[model samples]
Target: MNFFKTTYTSKLVFTALVIFSSSCSDDYLEEMTYGEISPSEMTSPGNVDRAIIAAYSLLNGQYDASSSAFNSPASNWSFGDVVSDDAYKGGGGTGDQNNIHLMEIFNTNPTIIDIERKWVALYEGVKRTNEAMRLLQNSQEYDVALKENRMGELYFLRGHYYFELKKIYNTIPYIDETAATVNDYAVSHTQYTSEQLWDKIEENFSNAYERLPNDQEEVGRPNKMTAKAYLAKTYIFQGQWQNALDAANEVINSNKYSLLPNFRDVFLPENDNSSEIIFAVQHSVLDGAPDNYNGSIGDRLSAPGGPFYSQYGFHRPSQNLVNAYKTNAIGMPVLDNKNLAEADFVDPRLDHTVGRPGIPYLDLGVLYEASWARDLSTYGPFAPKKRIVSANSPYQIKTWPYISALNYYIIRYADLLLWKAEALVELGDLEGARAVVNQVRGRAKDSQYVMNLEGTTPAASYRIETYNTPWTDQATAREAVRTERRLELALEGHRFFDLVRWGVAAETINAYLEVEKTRRTHLTNANFIEGTHNYFPVPQKYLDYLASTK
Candidate 1:
């Protein structure tokens, strides 16, 4: 349980040396000590454990090495949500975090700080995992099965890091343990095709699935089902529908996870490691760090300004997202491009996921007013709610930038279910996909709905029901599943990636901007070009580094 408590400063120093040596002359590199420990010294089991912990530490995507906390957030809030239709960059103004603003408006370039910082953070994760794997491979004193299990965890971590890199940059150099020299580390991004990069990512998860245990004693460590879940996700991203469906079925058949009874409870600190979570970036407060950096530091800017919360409000939900929650008289989504009117019945999950005007903000004893939003005119009136811990909760830190020990789920059971549903739809199992989607909807329908200020009545005319009718058409079923993903996982840092994977980022985001620009003037000139904007440009620094080597 104390797996995350250890610090891996020496490992980080070693990683820095490896990258630094890549630029040094042969004589200078030969004189330098590349690592804190020699290969013989790393043979200790304790050293290997520390190395593994070091790899896991990068999951939050924040370190002393990073330039800004928000630039490299573990949750992908900036790249995934803000860049998509789910959210807007809600800070001081349009100029505040202008780099992110550039991203939100689809005016991104390789020089943007967020692009570089995120690349660095994810690659740092890759380095830590590689270092851990190296140590584990060299170690002789560790238990055989335990060593394999630890290796499995390391592979899973690396797979996750590379997956993020692949989705964000589209092309990246793949470095593994065999890469000992500068040239090996500087392998060209174009060396592998897109399909090959996915294959590499899938190999890691497959290794993990083969080696990991069914259950892990440590809470944060991934298990067999977790690997399988990720494999399913990876396969879906590759459009390998059969492979994805098979992997998903393996996890779903295990019945190891289910939806939490209450939709809102999933994000609570107390339920950080709940059964609904497949894997999450585990956060801790007051874990002896100078600041609460080990907490949700990446999401610190997302706190809504109010009587009970910090003032640096960012990651405001979009009005489009709010409107997407509107349900018809039959308690199903409206599935149109209309604005949300006061009397429109909405899915109850809306209140749990977003903070709208007049709704009680998570039992804070006060209604969420427009004043809680930092920049209402630029980002609209909504505030992010799902990931924010209750102000009264013990998990929240009483500090300047109020962070909380709320774990950000990388993959939740509901997300996995949706992936399964998506795969089913692609595989032409419309009924199967409907049943899975309904399983998710049934939980939302049965869960406790958000209440009014007095806690006496339902907050809005909340109504959501599963599809009672059969899904007959593939196109309709596909849209239904995709829409379900948007509503169920809104503002959770998966929107943009989902759109890109679905090959609708250009169409969807352009259409979103066409209407959203009218509502928020900042997006007046925003555009999403198909080929150029599919992935962020490779970081200028990385390209420069590659150039220097040449």
Candidate 2:
């Protein structure tokens, strides 16, 4: 028998038979299968709910720790931040998490442990989601609409998993309920073209949007708008401008979500499930959270290590990224400020995003110093801040101070606004696009900057202004939207992908490395070759696994 069949059948027979003779037969109970129940026996609504939760559990991408650096983290900080111009591999040195270091310099290969670990972790999510889907499909206990909704969620999760893989590796295997075992997961990544893969992902989101309810009582559950935003994102990535615009318009016009009053509040623990958040991976600090799977492990690895917290300083921001925040006296970006040491006027969002020297770090009242960095010389003086939780927040996991239950947003409304602006710009609506971009900038304009201990004065020369005049042309609007995304969403793990999709990764990153080399000597070897470095090499173990089976 097949493994699932054999295991399940054995369980059924074991529970049905009794060891005692006919005298004891009268006392024998026709009890339910209490242990090792097969999929057939696991048909109750309660059991199906458990399986659905199991599918959602992998959203945080936590598995029992085996390796550190390349372990599959859902956050994609290493790929999105560390390898991009936004950050450095901020740990000890090149020898530390050497796999990531190689990636930092564009020297990645299939043999790297991070490659293998990331591949395995994401595929594990796929496997779990697929298993849950298979079980749900076989279950008859759920009502029709309820089953469709649950199945839609599985589709979204699967699409998200495949989307990550597609972005990073370009070509990847697509698996679902049809493929249920280890051998089934061994399909080749070359089976589908890149466009074909994106189509498959889009199909999932479309199904999710159609089947999911407009509003869910549970805050964490994805609704129709959630899937629509993701669908818009997928279309945006593919330059399906008209499709992206329509999808974005649907979410925006529905008025289901809006930007938070303060941009900083979006990241805080107390303000979770705010109007801004469309879909976020819900984490919990409550005890017995299944090996802490519900907590964000990425924060622990990237947070301040020595003096600040018992963590590894892995995702430090680069000086180049810090300098990108520089604004002119007019409150517009000082696009060509090569000679300026300190910006005469800087964007307020900068202080919120990066922990610079002498600035007060959050509500801790501690002025951030250069010593906070694990290696100031290698990674530069700045530390990451946007995702860092304040020590005073009650939502922090008590036992694991470093591991936080803070939700990581998969899609937020602000992103929707910006992406809609991008679509408009692409469609020759420069003036129309300017209004949308200015809306985002206006939010940053009103938001408070970092303050002193007494909350009296701003930390840096904080100043930002929205574009008062219409964007003259498409090029200008495009640049404005891109810059706004960099400043507004910096270090929240979307940089590299943005750069790559824009077809400027080589030009932008290569330029960043050159400037970065002068500031920190470690990046002297870093260069972005156009084709080879755009997507990471497929994991070698996959090739080996397929070869062995062949």
Most lDDT-accurate candidate: 1
lDDT of 2 by residue, 299-417 (tens): 56777653546556778987777777888777898776263365357888887888887888878878888788887778767788888887667665545436666778878888888
Candidate 1 residues lying further than 4 Å off, grouped into runs, are 5-12, 20-39, 65-67
lDDT of 1 by residue, 92-162 (tens): 99899999999988899998878877887787677778878987888879899899899999999999999
Q: Which 10 consecutive residues of model 1 have the lowest summed lDDT?
A: 25-34
Q: Give the TM-score of candidate 2.
A: 0.91
> What clash count goes with each model?
0, 0
Residue 386, candidate 1: C-alpha displacement in angstroms: 0.6
Q: What is the lDDT of candidate 1?
A: 0.85
TM-scores for every predicted model: 0.95, 0.91
